[model samples]
Target: MEQFTEVFLEFINSWGYFAVSFLMALENACIPIPSELILGFGGYLIFIGKMSFSGALFWGMVGGLVGSLFAYYVGKYGGRPFVDQYGKYFLMKKSHVDSAQHWFDTYGISAVFFSRMLPVIRTFISLPAGFAGVNLYKFVFYTILGSLPWTALILYIGMALGENWQVLRTIGHEVSIVFIILMVIVVGILYFRRKQKR
Candidate 1:
């Protein structure tokens, strides 16, 4: 982990905000780039006076929008049959894809906005939004709104924590893990309860 952190910091330090933004955009598009690390390091850069807060936020948002659009285009052009056929290879379930499509249908552009704030789900949400035929302009607008604040928050935490920035990174990872676990437990309990009621 330390080696990975060192390599990441070196890359970010050398490449600066552009690298951070590009990686962040890729991360959002399910590239496994670790958004927390990028944002945290970016924040640390800001803390050390290497970058500006607004600059970080701007690039982060741009990266997010670009990455999301990549996924959206994939879904739009690939269609449901393509996803149903190949998504499993990517560890994606048909039901999960279907659910996201349903949510997009029901909530419209707001689904894009809200999903961007979510952790793991945010990565895949844009595809469904596109598949559901959300307006392109609305999609971009809400995606920006949803993503900018999320990016800003992570950056702010890093800046505020300063030398203790690692704590924020640890907290982000732990919280995401805990949240996923709790969600699984809740789903399991609800499923069994529904079976009993039936």
Candidate 2:
């Protein structure tokens, strides 16, 4: 992990803002690249005068939007079968798709907006949204809206922490784990309840 972090940091350092867009794009594409690390490091750069807050925020959001659209299309065209059959190669799971689908089913279009603020759900919700055939413009609009605060908050933490920005990455990672565990338990309960109803 340390070595990976070094490589990731070096990549961003070498490429400047483009790295922010590329890395964040990969993250939102459900590639698990860790936005916290990207944005946090971006913040640290801002502190050192290597980046501007607005530039980081703009590029980060752009990357997120692009990546999400990519995932959305994958879900729209590929649908569930593609994910079920080939998702494992990308570290995706049927359960993840199901959970995202359930959230969309339960919450409708608003789920797209709100889920973007969450951890695991934020990353996976685009897939189900695409699969559900949600309006493209609306998805893009809400995606940008939902991502703004999260991107800003992480970047702010990174900036405030400066050289210690990696701390946010560590904390964000732990928080994501907790959310994943909680999601699993909720999925398990819901599964059992449905079984009981059947």
Candidate 3:
């Protein structure tokens, strides 16, 4: 995780805002690139006067919108049946995939909006949204709305942290671990409950 953060930081440092957009697109694509570090570093650049807050924020949001398209298409076309067959090879579980769909169905707009600030949920909410046959305009609209707070907060923190932006790298790593554990627990509960019902 640390290495990933460093690699992304270097990549962005070299290419400026383009790297921000590119990497963020990949992150939203569900590639696990950690937007906290990406946008935070963008903020740090703003602090140093190398990039503007608006540029970083705009490109970051654009990248998220573009990146999410990949998952959306995959879900729209391939769907649960497709993921069910191939997911294990990629270390994904059917339960995890289904959970996203369940949440989107159950929570509606709030799910999409709040999930954007969460760790794993934020990364994956789009796929489920796609699976649920959400309208394209609605999906894009809420995705942007859902994305704004995190991007702005991380960028602002990165700007404030300046040379210390790497602090967020550590936080991002920890947050990911916690979310993984949380998912495992949720899955376990769902499994046991299903068993008892049977």
Candidate 4:
């Protein structure tokens, strides 16, 4: 993993902003490039004046949209049987894709909006969205909308920690833990509110 991380960092170092787009695109396309590292590293560079935050963020989103389109096409054309046959190459299984599909089905469009803020679900939601054949424009709209804040937050985390982006990892994990707790509390409140109204 360290060797791979070094190679990835080196690639980004050589190419500048385009490297962030490429890696982020690959990540959204099911290649697992770790956006945290990419954005965080970009953030560090911004601190050093090597890259602009907006430029990094813009290309990151563009690359993500492009990669998502690729995956969407794949899932739309390939379907479950194709995934069942070839998913292993992407380090995936039918079950993983199925779980993503189930989430998409259960939650409808909001799933697309929120999934971009989550981890595993963010990666695979495009598959089921494609398979289900949701409106293309709406998918693009919601995807970009959902992705913007996440991209900004990740980049900010990266920038804040500068060269010590690993520290951002700990920060991200803690944030996720807190987010989950907050979601639980919010849901409980809503549930009780509904009961009282009834």
Candidate 5:
């Protein structure tokens, strides 16, 4: 993991703001790329005079918007058939899909806005919005509103932490991995227990 981190740091350091923006966008698009790492390391770079903070934030926001829109469209046009067929591959269940759809129906665009702050939930939230046929304009507006702050917050954290930013990056990565593992375990346990009950 340390070696991989070093390699990633080297790559980003060499590539500069463009790499940060690309990684941020890919991460937002449900690609499992850690936005925190990009932002934090970018911040450290700013501290070291390797990159500009404003440039980092600007590109990060652009990447986030692009990636999120990709997910939104995938969910919207692909429909439940795609979800039902491929969701399990992504650790999603039919009930989870149904629940997200229900949430979108009940909460509307607000759900999209709020879901942006959640960890794992944020990745999948767009699907329900798409499946529910939420207005594209409203979806984009809410998504950007929710996502920009998230992108900015992480990037700022990166900028602020500077040389010691790796501490936060490590913590964030561990937390994300643990969260994903726990979610899978909990979901699997619930699924089997529910099957037994039924």
Candidate 6:
């Protein structure tokens, strides 16, 4: 994780706004890149006058939106078939896929909007939105709306902390760990319940 962070930082340092956009795009495309690092460091740059807040924010948001659209299309066009064929390899079953699809159908707008505020879940929600065949316009709209606050918040923290920007990175790391553990526990509980039902 540290290594990946270093690499991303190096990219941002050298490439500036383009790096922010590119890295953010990759992050939102279901890649493991963390936006916290991207925007947080960007905020630091803003504080130091190396980068502008509005420029960084705009590029970051645009990149995220573009990546999300890419992932959404992938899920819409290719996800269902891929999941159907190979989901079991990833501990995903037809029922699980169906449940996810149903959940999106039922609560897609809120889910898409709120998930963006979360740490880990935000990165991958686009795929499910696509798989559920959510309305494109609605999906895009909520994604933009949801991502704005998160982007702005992290950037603000980075800028506010300035020289102590690493603090936000540290906090983000810990938060990610907690969320990951909780997710694992939830998945384990659900897996066990499914086994019992079977």
Best by lDDT: 2
102-134, model 1: which lDDT tens digit per residue?
767787778887666555667778888767777
The alpha-carbon deviation from the true structure for residue 75 of candidate 4, after best TM-score superposition, in angstroms, is: 1.2
Better of 1 and 3 by TM-score: 3
- What's the true lDDT of residue 38 in model 4? 79
The Cα local distance difference test for each model comes to 0.78, 0.86, 0.79, 0.80, 0.73, 0.80
My TM-score estimates for the predictions, one after another, are 0.76, 0.84, 0.79, 0.86, 0.73, 0.76
Give the candidate order by descending TM-score: 4, 2, 3, 6, 1, 5
Q: Any runs in candidate 3 off by more than 4 Å, and if so which?
A: 86-99, 172-198
Residues 1-198 of candidate 2: C-alpha lDDT, one tens digit per residue: 345888889989888799999998988888767788899999999999999999999999999999999999999999988988988898776777788899999998888877876777788889999888899999999899878878888889899998898888669856555644665698799999999999
Better of 2 and 5 by lDDT: 2
Model 5 Cα lDDT, one tens digit per residue, 55-147: 888887788777777767778899879878976765566775576566677877788876665665566678877777889889889888777
Best by TM-score: 4
Q: Candidate 2 clashing pairs?
A: none
* Model 6, TM vs. native: 0.76
Candidate 6 RMSD to the correct structure: 9.8
Name the TM-score of candidate 5: 0.73
User: Between candidates 4 and 5, which one is better according to TM-score?
Assistant: 4
lDDT of 4 at 130: 82
Once superposed on the true structure, which residue ranges of model 1 sit more than 4 Å away at CA? 1-6, 84-106, 173-198
